[model samples]
Target: MDFSALNKSAANSFNQQKSLIKKVLAGKKVKCNNCNTLISVHTGADSVMIKCEKDCTDIKLDAELLK
Candidate 1:
């Protein structure tokens, strides 16, 4: 019956993730753990992806993080 708590929790989660994304973007040391190469960030219509150029790692996140 109480949605306020749920909404606040969700908002907090989103904010945390967004902050992480910003850090990743601003960091120059971001690299693929598997291959030790630089990772690439790509944004699409509904999603964002962080991938290694050598195909060693791939991460997909919600596009809302970029907003």
Candidate 2:
């Protein structure tokens, strides 16, 4: 195995996670619908997936429905 390559891959993964965390911190947040758990949100994203509490169900939110 190429240790250097593995380290580089890990570093890249770390950077991506760090960036996502920073983005989450900088973005808006709302409570999870079912559990009321606070979750970060990225409104402008294309939204591949938005989940709360790792591996848990995703909460769907609609402004109209909230009203």
Candidate 3:
């Protein structure tokens, strides 16, 4: 079975997610898929976090994405 295509697809998805995260970091509004509420992105000295007011979606991004 070919894995290159799968790898490429994964890479593309990752890039898209990173792009979205960057937009959030820049103060763009993003919504939570589960709760359909505004997502709040917070950046710290060493990490980035995203969450909704309802707490349905919470994710702590790797610090490397800050670049």
Report the CA-based lDDT of candidate 2 relative to the real structure.
0.52
Task: Write one digit per residue (lDDT tens) for candidate 3, span 1-67.
Answer: 6799999887877776667666677788888767789888767788878778897666688888657
C-alpha RMSD for every candidate: 7.2, 13.5, 4.5
TM-scores, all models, native as reference: 0.55, 0.30, 0.55
Residue pairs clashing in model 3 are none
Q: What pairs collide in candidate 2?
A: none
Tens digit of per-residue lDDT, candidate 1, span 1-67: 6899999887877765455456667765576656888877887889988777886556688878667
Query: In candidate 3, where is summed lDDT lowest over 10 consecutive residues?
Result: 15-24
Among these predictions, the greatest lDDT belongs to 3
For residues 1-67, write the lDDT of model 2, one tens digit per residue. 9999999987876765455444454565644545766655434333333456642434333434323
- Model 2 is weakest, by summed lDDT over 10 consecutive residues, at 57-66
